[model samples]
Target chain A: MAESSRADNRVLLLKLGVIACVMFAFAWALIPLYRVICEVTGINQLVKADAPAPAVAASDLAVTAAPVRLRFDATVQAGLPWQVRPLVGQMAAPRGEFVRVDYEITNASNREVTGQAVPRYLPAAAGNYVKKLECFCFRQQVFKPGETRRFPVVFVIDRAMPADIGEITLAYSVFDVPGQGAS
Target chain B: MAISTTAGHAPHEHGKPTGLWRWLAATNHKDIGSMYLWFSFTMFLSGGVMALCIRAELFQPGLQFFQPELFNQLTTLHGLVMVFGAIMPAFTGLANWLLPLMIGAPDMAFARMNNWSFWLLPPAALLLLISFFVPGGAAAAGWTLYAPLATQMGMGMDLTIFAIHILGVSSIMGSINIIVTILNLRAPGMTMMKMPMFAWASLITAYLIIAVMPVLAGVVTMVLTDRHFGTHFFNAAGGGDPVMYQHIFWFFGHPEVYIMALPAFGIVSHIIPTFSRKPLFGYTSMVYATSSIAVLSFMVWAHHMFTTGMPATAQLFFMYATMLIAVPTGVKVFNWIGTMWQGAMSFETPMLFAVGFVCLFTVGGLSGVTLSVAAVDIQLQDTYYVVAHFHYVLVAGALFSLFAAIYYWFPKMTGKMYSEPLGKFHFWWSMIWFNVTFFPMHFLGLAGMPRRIPDYALQFTDFNRIASIGAFCFGLGQLIFLYNMLRSIRHGQAAPHKPWEGAETLEWQIPTPAPYHSFVEAPHVEAGDNGVIHSMTGGAHH
Candidate 1:
């Protein structure tokens, strides 16, 4: 009886050990699982990469309705030794019609520097409605010593945007990317 | 039989080692249980000191004694110490001492491994304590160690991570030991269904620990690698979402709540019935309630993350799932009251605590249900309401149950009875002051007072002062418990075997102070024989 009990103990221990190992692996498994869920559900919008906009027919554009006022803003993060300013302060563009805005960047530092631009939308909900066709924020940019460059941002505000939001501000802040060169 | 060979070297037969070696190389369950209890009590005091420091700073509005950073460290350490150091180990100690004796087993299935499991704790605790002196101070990011904040902490965070790893390993080993002993070492006729409620609770709790402690280890490892090894598991710049960390942590954490409570449920189940002089009401339902709670615990992890911007559908699903827990929990509560109904009941110190646990834990449970609403949680999250909610469940629920167990088993453990008046005094003192300290936090939380801050606005002054004063008194009350326990161990009245008339279990069937070896020959139990009923009605022993 004792011998059988001892054998039973060994089998139970092995089973429990396997459970612990499997749970540990499950924790690691959650990472990819979480990403897949977020993408499939279109939740966790901040983490999801911006998808390329599908082709829009002319009839889909709301060209005759009232235009929404758009405000452009740009700033360089501290210690980056870079300056950025919107070439156009603001514009009014009809809903569903694409609008283009320009911003100029200058590197004041002596060495070539790599930086990434992150964009923020005012009233954060606007992020879901404003679709970007092309933007400098999509990738890291490299500026040579004393270099100046111009970048264009093209976007269309969906007609489904709430009417209460008459104006939207699109802001960009550039942060230095350490330990990386232009790829 | 292998049992006789192992029993030949029983400490009682060969005369056991004395002094430090007795504890250091101890394989006996009772001695290891005693060590675990003492270690947890020390940790309880350490965590209590941190709590008092926090209350002191929050006594008024401004930062008087501690910097915000230091205050953050105190709150963080207090939480980690209480949950991991004080509460979890206390339950493990209770299991170590009680499970084998209750189930008529010779000793734990893996006794040597039990020693290693316990000894690992001191080093891990030492690591946590010393982290405070490190260059950046301890991990200032709260006990949750939510990332971005956690990733920015200094060397102390790494120490905390390593300590948690060691602690996790200890818990897993201890849990494995428990599962094996309960499953494999029952005597000839003590079937799983016939075992005491405490044994069933411990069995389920061990499985819960086995399932979740590894996940905790895994998440903390990711944090360590993120800080030093260029991994971006939580770094948004590297395509890792911080919310994902919340998801994984709560997956382990929600069940962790029951890991603390289930053992308390077991302890209270014994105390209430023993005092009431009645068989436990709805014994079968009690087991089902415990098992259901464990299973549902895994599904409600997302409730803690309602404010983390989960979609409304996910939020609603988690909210409803969280609320669904209250049903089985309510069933257990109902059954406890049902046991005490229309019985010849006594108000022993243990019973007082058991009753207190029932009442206050209900309040905590109700508040938990209130917080389960995703919309309401948006307001209550990070408030003193959350703090108040858990303290009720933990302090009133788990800690109260621990006190009751100590009192209920005092004579059995020490071979002497504690001073009754002093025991009652300790109970009332802790009971009143505990409410004074935590109950007002509910109001403060409702008034929009955020938690974990060094200072509050002027309007939040009066209640904070009351809570602080109550906290100091609450801290003082524990000393009485300490004194009673120590004095009783040495000078209290000598107890006979079966000190409590209504007490009925295999442990009570043994000698006082319980011998170093018991049940060398497995005791045979018969079908349809509840241990309590048979023993009380003059049934055969062995």
Candidate 2:
């Protein structure tokens, strides 16, 4: 009888704990979930896709000048096994204008390096670009020892390139070169 | 003087089991439940390993060094194995184990069929595993096996189809058994209303399985026929609509989601009151809520397909229907809170996990509500947001509940107390690291990062990088849990007759190191009608 009393009391306490916590979690999540629902249903469009800014200076889509002499300061990655050199330089272009940049590479590993140079476009947080021509991404690139090669990329910034989009950053890593099964 | 031992007063009935043998061999209700619990736990760990593999590969991205195809396989296998292998089986395992245990029955209504049902699982798992070696690779199309792409895969597709068939057969058999058991096996005094919450949940889940496992089976069979027999169920060129497959699939697939989660609801209901010191707050409502969710599940199938060029009104209907689920589900959540109100709460390891399960599972649930809205789902649907959302539910929601169940019941299973410190450590690490891992994916996903892509545009890097680190931590945290399970099973502190300081259940009535044939002569159960133990007198319940 004594043990049974303890069991009864304990069950009541546990039942209360579960009920309280479950309700709290449910209520706590309701706000965010409702926001999500609003976002999905567009009933309350509280969250909007961040809009890109339009160009201030480069209103024109066409480049006024031909490809001028261009060069970029280059450095190899620290302790990096591969040889990499930037082959493109900074340039000014009108809004909605297209540009190209290149990187040269040589395989430093004993094995052949073959993979695409995956490009990451960090477009000033407000601009967008479409890559029309590319070498070595989602495809493959192969470099043997002392094999010097240039990887070229062609891109166009939309007229919506935000006025603040002065620095267009492109970061590339040669990857999926089918290395050891370390991953 | 040599005194002969009296038959009625042997020292704890040495060498006499409490009918646990039936759980091992006989196709009975009690035996099946035990088998399901054990099987699900084992698969839970195995699927955990697969999750770890995904984390390891994505730990750095840039092919930090892994096969791309194999990476795809890991993500695919993680989903397949967890769905078909871990969560599905675990629930079924619970159904097999508990539905009978709680329902006041000697065995499942169909005993031999019950044995046959469980036997299907191992072969299916083996076939799924064997696909990894199938010449080119495993089924790269994913568990969904969306056609054209699925049909394009090589011989391994055959193995995947076979595995699905076996899994379907297993599910169907389990469901049939449940339906029969629930309909036929109630004791004289037990009415359906008087049945345990787990039984109620089981009844609904079984109905779902019967309805949809066949649809899934039928779909896979068509895939087989398409591949070998020239049937064109999903072939557009052959006048079949690929979208029709999606329709049929999500039709089965939507309810299938409830099929996995509703049992979890049942489990939490069982566990909370045992530890919280309260009666289950809304027993009848919980039963109603479960049934409502199941019925609503069928209507909400199209919600998953709104972004697939569905008509506007259809999408609206789906959105409204999907959002309505929150009502009963809210009731359940309210019920759980009611069960825990003002209770003298203690945090035994099981209770800790139960608390964690409630919090984390809610996060997943709310996210589910988020996607149920059609517009937000359009952006969030295919992205890492969806990935983050579902994983939160499955891992934090379903899997964590399973952990709590283990902590609560491990004593009865093995007569040992897992290290409390270790279990707590495991719980905190997983809870912390899991959030660290999955929370950021929401932002990345909202920022428009699509899932299943090997690489992403550079702007999404910071969140992905943070997510990757969290993934690694989450993966590592699981080791603590795995270690606890192994260590406790082999060498933990010896358990007393009742392990939890304040647990009350039929299972706890047995002695420590529960005899094998427990309940051969069933204890005259006298708990209140709704699984709350009010008191009964028996020693060791032999």
- Please report the candidate that would top DockQ against the real structure: 1
What TM-score does candidate 2 reach?
0.70
Looking at model 1, residue B541 earns an lDDT score of: 23
Q: Which candidate comes out best when scored by TM-score?
A: 1
**What tens-digit string does per-residue lDDT give for candidate 2 at A69-92?**
222333332223567667655665
lDDT of 2 by residue, B252-339 (tens): 7888888888877877887788778777887888888999999999898888787777767778989999999989988988888888
Q: Specify the poorest-scoring 10-residue window by lDDT in model 2 chain B.
A: B1-10
Q: How many angstroms is residue B36 displaced in model 1 relative to the true structure, after the best TM-score fit?
A: 0.6
For each candidate, give its TM-score against the true structure: 0.87, 0.70
Off by over 4 Å in 2: A1-183, B1-35, B522-524, B535-542
Residue A153, candidate 2: C-alpha displacement in angstroms: 39
What TM-score does the predicted chain A of each candidate obtain versus native chain A?
0.65, 0.50
Over B250-309, each residue of candidate 1 has an lDDT whose tens digit, in order, gives 899999999999999999989888889888898888999999999999999999988877
